[model samples]
Target: MRWRAGVVAALAVAVLLGACGGGEEPVAATASRTPKPLPISTPTSIQQRCFVPVEGGLTTFTGPEGSTMPGAVLGEGADVAVFLHQTSAAGFCGWATYADWVASKDVKAVLVDLCGWGRSACKGGFAADAEAQVRLLVDWAREHGARRVTVVGASMGGAIALGVGQRAGADALVDLSGPAVWQGVPTAGEAAKETTVPLLLAVAPGDRGMDPPALRAAVKAAPAKHKRFVSTRGSHGWDMLNDGALTEPKWSPLAHDVLAWVKGEYRAG
Candidate 1:
């Protein structure tokens, strides 16, 4: 009993000393509380770090698999126009100006960065990842009360859009300089054959790595019911967004055609 009392008194003193910061924490205790090195950045953490609320219409959304996808939402119309970027690595930034124009036309213009491009992250092949991620945004727009959703993509993004628009149930699709085949897949031409939504396929004459005529033919043969193939004069991809001279109207011949065509599609739908 006497030894038990002595042990209890010693333990109480030790506790008090520890509480008052008079005792050093054991090595094991200190190591256990070291905060686990803040686990590697997963999709959620990546979103928190890179995807923040931005000014001037910029926003972030979660991908299908939880990646943080950055984009911009311009205007507040129930009809949504989701713009997917090309493979140039410029991401959503490349589509900003054109998207602004689309927004001004009384539509909700959304410029999106595909997975593994821009600030977005994903763990899969580029084509597949892009398709899934973009679909997430389309579904998001519909869930948020969009009456219609149109996916417009350029180059590689355009190829992916050929398939994504149909799969995501988008009201329409615009493929700018998209190839009939991409990344060893018949992403555009074959997908076009199955497209049930309204479609617009535009290409410049000099754009390489794409068979514009074949693509046009494929689109025309598709059962989309509403489709158009606009032939323009320009370089490729984003270059097709502007006229070479950068004149007053500024928009490329293709851009003008796309705008007019899309406007009609929106009105018809």
Candidate 2:
């Protein structure tokens, strides 16, 4: 679209101007002071805004013309929540564990397709700045009445999630196998240290991508009153969500159980 093309031109200059900078943003075409809202089009697939995971689950989310492919929004209910996938898992569908949990609790889910890769790639097929993509999702949530949002991010998505957790005013955050540092972006550990929201940082001892030592350190430093750390046997991220997988896979029920706790399933009236 012409919109993405214009943004590409601006970002090209910005990328050229900054070499050793953080990747935390996007470039959108300028809008008039009073712009008209894009007409909402009937979605090609209800699966985009429906329950259950499916093959090639990517969906289109409009920006200005109601025709852009921003990402997928899942579930449909009162409690608004957002889920971010890992960089490696982009465009893939493995959130059934978390989605099931949310569905059981009657929560509305916004499953952000980690843009810049796979099926979530930007409209112009150019890489979007990581942080900018996150801000876009969070801002969209805000405008759509997603208050007290809960954020769940894994790996690269976890880092970006932390970068905006407090800014998004999330009530709670869950980080699975997220690294303390990545590609010059501010570490989730740093954000953990500063946030007061309830946080649960889970990591497998053998998780190759996530740094256990730094995660433990950050967890210790986090000032959140309800923060907790779980060292489980599952691989990482959604892999840790496996509670009923084969016995030999080094499985753990951390994902399903912790989510139950974070959403206050354990709280008594």
Best by TM-score: 1
The C-alpha TM-scores of every prediction are 0.72, 0.65
Whole-model lDDT for model 2 versus the true structure? 0.61
Query: Candidate 2 on 97-196: residue-level lDDT in tens?
Result: 4555565566666765565544454544223455455555657766777645667777766666665666656677777788878774568667777878
**Deviation in Å, model 1, residue 37 alpha carbon:** 22
Report how far residue 267 has shifted in candidate 1, in Å.
Answer: 11
For model 1, the run of ten residues with the poorest summed lDDT: 45-54
Prediction-by-prediction clash tally = 0, 3
90-151 per-residue lDDT for model 1 (tens digits): 56766666766777788788877777688766544543555567678888888888887888
C-alpha lDDT score of every prediction, in listed order: 0.71, 0.61
- RMSD (CA, angstroms), candidate 2: 19.8
Candidate 1 at 182: error in angstroms?
1.5
